[model samples]
Target: MRQLNKFTFNICPTVSIHNQINLLSNEDIKYTFNDFQKNKQIISCVDNFSEIERDECHIYFCPYESKEYHKITNNFPGGIFIHVHEIALFDEQPFEHKSFFQISQSFRFMKKLTLINDKRSRKLHDNNEHLSIIKYPHLSQLDLSEAQDDYIEQFLVDTKTCLPNSFYLCCRLSSTEKSDTTLCKKYNMNKLFKSAFVMFNCIFQGLSLFDRRFNQLRVLHVNSSWIRYSSRLTINNTENLPNLKCFSLYCDTDTVVYDELIVPLLHRMLDLEKLHLYLIIGYKNTFIDGNNLKRNIINHMPPLNIFTFNIRTTVHLHNLN
Candidate 1:
């Protein structure tokens, strides 16, 4: 009673990890798992355990409706089990890669993840190879947008998962460049995909608007009839987009998606800032000519600030009746 046996966790070091922790009828989670054995990264959750009743400093859990799985307890030292930060892996089955490497070792300081399994995972197409590569070293933010697509080839296919560095990904599939005609397998979908967040009717199939392997692409919104038939490529692979700023295209008629692939992909994005087009060009009419739209795309984007255009042109051949 003299301060309960001299316990001073610097004054309640935040201990609340329950959703299933009985610890033999829970005496305040067995005195908060024996003062967390002298601090273990202030564990918030998921240290991945389902068996630990040793009673002398081993209380890992899995109590609710327990079917038990992991047995963690070598007197503690598997990196004291990573402190779970934030993880969301909703399932209705199908989650292979050994349940994503046991949730990357029970959420090792996971940053922010949200996956809503759409069911696939046949060992991600059965070439298991002893499955390893699943690491989430302080992951940034990853929402699979209702995942499926084998979880986008199981985390951008860098042999299965190892993302970081500005890592922020939100997904919502589309063609996914299924034919491989210069999609280069979506540049293996990872080279930091510039913090990817694709899916505006996403269709960049048959590559066109520049790709020095996505040269750290910034942002591109496409759906202009599948990019007006491969948006006129071949000017040395459309020169330098140099980390394209931000762009959008939403054509429905296409006089070649605005004077030939949106003015040669906006003169190779000379560091474009932002521009959105809702073009419907077809009657040609030179894109409402204003000195050829200021010498072809407002003077080659001197760092365009923000310009939205709906300056349309259409005879609406209406997709040929």
Candidate 2:
């Protein structure tokens, strides 16, 4: 068997080349480039001019190391996954001294882009003048979970020209320390939600519920913190997300006041078929009527087939009907 015909390259550190090849043979493999130094052997083997083939390939890179993968992206044009940590890295020049935006522009055939950020990762700084200068027209799915508020804003501003069909944003609570709280206040969650809706209209179909524009969005996810500060921000209009089918929200803290934010948001997603919520109720003196809330949810979103909610110690799941 020809090597190019049988093997798929994976730039992950945890799995060996043999194991990756075996996994690739059994199922489609999504390569995550975490530590390139550790995978040098596999990289060298696949780097051979005869073995490398230009087929549909997916590449995932750590935000800071996207530069490292630029040299090899020519052979992979299917998609790119960027795990964003510090926004500054994207601004830095690497591999022939090209910025990430310039390097990304080389792959016009690329169709999907995934941006990921987690709580443990450092927050995105307020200054994003350097990032978000380019747009990928072929992307169909754009996921920006646990990203800094400024980063998302900059992305929306830059990519307003191109809208993906699926979009996701997950917000985690920052520490309540005075310094962090001050920074969080600068990036209000309410404004972020509002901007997301406005930008969604610019790229894809207009929001269906509002009859403002066509709705091409299908999947949406939001994970937020229940700190007292976020209580004021409500996802008041579900009509803005009429086409959404799968919706999930994980509330990090225990607070009933958050119900004010969640309930109204649920009411607006009338088209949702799947719903997941990690809620905190009755942790201390605060209390919420779970049964009544559930009934209200059912009444509003009649099309729901899968409903799951985790309320502190209790979990309720309603499977497909």
Candidate 3:
């Protein structure tokens, strides 16, 4: 490790980005790179990061308190691209949307980013569900393990930030030592590829944790009511488990219809050839008729071969003579 000479600089709080996909207004890249100072702590730069211990290769901007402590400026530059791989942002100040934009401007290829702020986020002006979303195109792991309440809204809120496609963010206690799978997926992480998921004993909060589709999954059996997110899968842009061939869900009693929860879930199984549903359904506005199966569910799953379901629906006849 070569001696890292500390260079000081200053950076604007908010940077304007034009090409940031799914983000704010398009106006060419208006970000500027100013020179580093001799004796200041506004912005800091040290470019000796290389896999093989080289010089002036990877630039890492990590801002802290002064809203300038972490900005990675390129003074001794080989090229414009700053290859910051791992970053740990520690600050006492509350992080706002601008804080992310500043990071996103330079760390386009950052793999692992850790945020260490306990304070909440201050909402930006005109913040809404339809606002431009800040996207991290190549970021694979974001360790919000030390973030807090306002961080959830700043990161998880659909309108604020956009992670990679099929990205699933899970939050467990940082102290807990268990790895739980997403709602739609549960595979052994140690084993890269898994074919079947069969659990007829324990009931999980069905579809509540399902975020991404399982393409390699062929069989899934669960003892679950399977009613949550029945109306939200499509809206959330959840793709189908395309390769699933067999699915069996058994529920003791549920008040959901085939249209709402059951069929919407089945529609995701594009390649499913066999299905078995044991459901005791009651008190729904609509009953599961043959057409409901044929048009709503079956029509979507083109390769469906054997369709079997035991459903009982109780309907109330009103104003009968």
Candidate 4:
């Protein structure tokens, strides 16, 4: 114990004590929590609630299907940082699930929030009265990937709230459950696309880019399959993406590289420094006029430092002189 404590200080005395505690094993969790309990130090729980810190620690409760989950959370000190995953279970008579508003108002110092895989039973209600009271100025990241559409809309309605630089809103929806139009209208999808500055590795399935603008976008990645299927479809307001630096497109078919789609799209990204195009041509004798396409792409785009075009059997790389 003496050697371990001495080694900890030697590594970094100012390192967050919570991070150091997280390195312990399950058996060590119990012993460490017990030690913290004895010393009355701030105890933070991530994944399990082996120790109760009352009102003096951050707590992250992963999906736990115990009726005692709510009781454990209720005992946490007000204004404490808490992250709850999925739905909080309850087994009492007239069983009801906890709402996001309820969870948000329960703590005063909510620093970071992440909700994942919330079933329909515990879906957040839009009409919750406590929506106005929920505020977290210190929130560094928010992930609502598995939350319901209504819940996400309600949370984002308060535009005054400062969103973190890294925000994730990608959710998996069944094809039959919701149509593209319904989902787009419910979440104001176009507004979100324009506002985000750096979008990394996102799938835009069922989204329409007609007349939409990307004002602050720096990096954009989209699969060609995400584009709506229409003979007359065109991406409007491409000029609005003035800050786009890195653009990538994954084409499942060769037909998406026409002037209406790929050519015009690349022409709009005047500030792009990196461009990657992945084309998966089927098992048939096919070839793209690479020399012609290369000359055109170089003429339209800025002086790029890295450019990669990968087809099924051919690879083209260009570093401009």
Best-performing candidate as measured by TM-score: 4
Residue-wise C-alpha lDDT for candidate 1, range 1-321, written one tens digit per residue: 545633323111222345335533334545556655354433222233223212322333322122221322222223323545565664456667666677677657778778876667766666666768888888777877777766776677647678774566776664344333333444443265564555423454323535565567677555434444543334235667688688776646444445555677678788889988776567533336577667988799998989878766655444444
> Candidate 3 — number of clashing residue pairs?
6
The positional error of residue 235 in candidate 1, measured at the CA in angstroms, is 38
TM-score of 2: 0.46
Candidate 4 lDDT, tens digit per residue, 1-321? 644531111010122445455454434534554643243333343233333221123332222222222332333333333443322322111111333435555543444454443334232443445434455444433444444444354456544233344333333333222253344445444444332222212233312342343445566655544322343323343454577687777656434334444566677777778888776532223345676567658777766778888766333334222
Computed on alpha carbons, the lDDT of every model, listed in order, comes to 0.56, 0.41, 0.50, 0.43
Predict model 4's lDDT versus the native. 0.43
Top candidate on lDDT is: 1
* Steric collisions counted per model: 0, 4, 6, 3
True-structure Cα RMSD, model 4 = 10.9
Off by over 4 Å in 4: 1-114, 121-125, 128-130, 136-178, 182-207, 223-228, 231-240, 251-260, 281-286, 313-321
For candidate 3, report its TM-score.
Answer: 0.37
- Give per-residue CA lDDT, model 2, range 84-110, as digits (tens): 212212111111212335535554544
Q: Please say which candidate is ahead in lDDT: 1 or 4.
A: 1
The worst-scoring run of ten residues by lDDT in candidate 2 lies at 200-209
| Candidate 2 ranges with C-alpha deviation above 4 Å | 1-98, 114-133, 143-149, 159-216, 227-240, 283-290, 313-321
Query: Cα lDDT of model 3 overall?
Result: 0.50
